[model samples]
Target: MSNNINRSLIGNILKSIRVEKNIPMKKIASALKVSESTVSQIETGKNSATKEKINEICHVCGCSFDYKTDRKKMIDLVLYIYTQYSNLSTDEMNSTIEEVKSNSFISCSYVRFEYYLILYMDGIINQNNEDVQLFKRILEIGKSSFSNKELSIYYDIKALEKMYLNDSIKA
Candidate 1:
């Protein structure tokens, strides 16, 4: 099972987020009802987490569970929603987003929606076939980058623009 547990994207992302929050290993371990040794192993990328544990950790840390969805599921969800969101005018987009945020479940839903929006936007302004291909290429790259690093908001926004605009070359 050790081979099955090595260097997971989710484990690395969790480690990066935990470091960014400046929370101690023991604290996270306690919050997740696990041992410090387990947390340490996880942070070092020796193990991955179960989805249920990921949910509990997110609740305890007050951080969004940004990486809970697998790439295929994420892509499929975004593609389906893209069909709807693309049909809306800019004004409708703004209004719908605002109204959604007013709900109690906004935080959870918004995170997923926001993730989808970036991908949707990327698919919209495809300058050519090459541009579209690069966008998908970078989606995989983006996943790996986030595995051990926190993507800044500015970076995310810039990446979104470049992806949709075909301005960036798969970074």
Candidate 2:
């Protein structure tokens, strides 16, 4: 595939996901029993993932590309909002965070954290210092919608690490 993908998006998402897991690329590559170069290639988008690679990436990153549900779609919306409202003041994000904390809204849930991260993966929001903090909040409070429901927390843990720190997460 000659489609151009933003490398920074892939790299930041991979880096954040990897960092959240407290593991290294070598470890992930080892899990796949593939060369580190191969894993690196996929993350860097030097190569596109085949079926196996997609599953592997999904396993490694805890992201779902489910076509039937709103989980992924809602997250995309959040990212879009971020892009359109990049001009949103810190007050706005903080207000949204407060609103999320009040109830189990989508924006405050672990799901939302995953969504935000997906945006991060797409390079929608970058060069910000608040990401790590938001990630941390989601990790602490966000429940396991994907994992507890699907019988997998490996991805949830990896994905929610950043969210736990992010009080901005809804659930």
Local accuracy of candidate 2 as per-residue lDDT tens digits, 76-169? 4444444433465545644543443453333322244455443332232333444645554433333223234222322433444456447435
Query: Whole-model lDDT, candidate 2?
Result: 0.46
- Local distance difference test, per candidate? 0.49, 0.46
Question: How well does candidate 2 score on lDDT at residue 139?
Answer: 36
Which candidate should be chosen as best, given TM-score against the real structure?
2
Worst 10 residues of 1 by lDDT: 104-113
Q: For candidate 2, what is the TM-score?
A: 0.41
Candidate 2, RMSD to the unseen true structure: 12.9
- Estimate the overall C-alpha local distance difference test score of candidate 1: 0.49
Clashing pairs in 1: none
Error of 2 at 138 (Å): 13
Q: What are the RMSD figures for all models against the true structure?
A: 9.5, 12.9
Off by over 4 Å in 1: 1-7, 66-171
- Per residue, candidate 1 scores C-alpha lDDT tens digits across 75-125 of 444444444455655555445434433542322321333342344344443
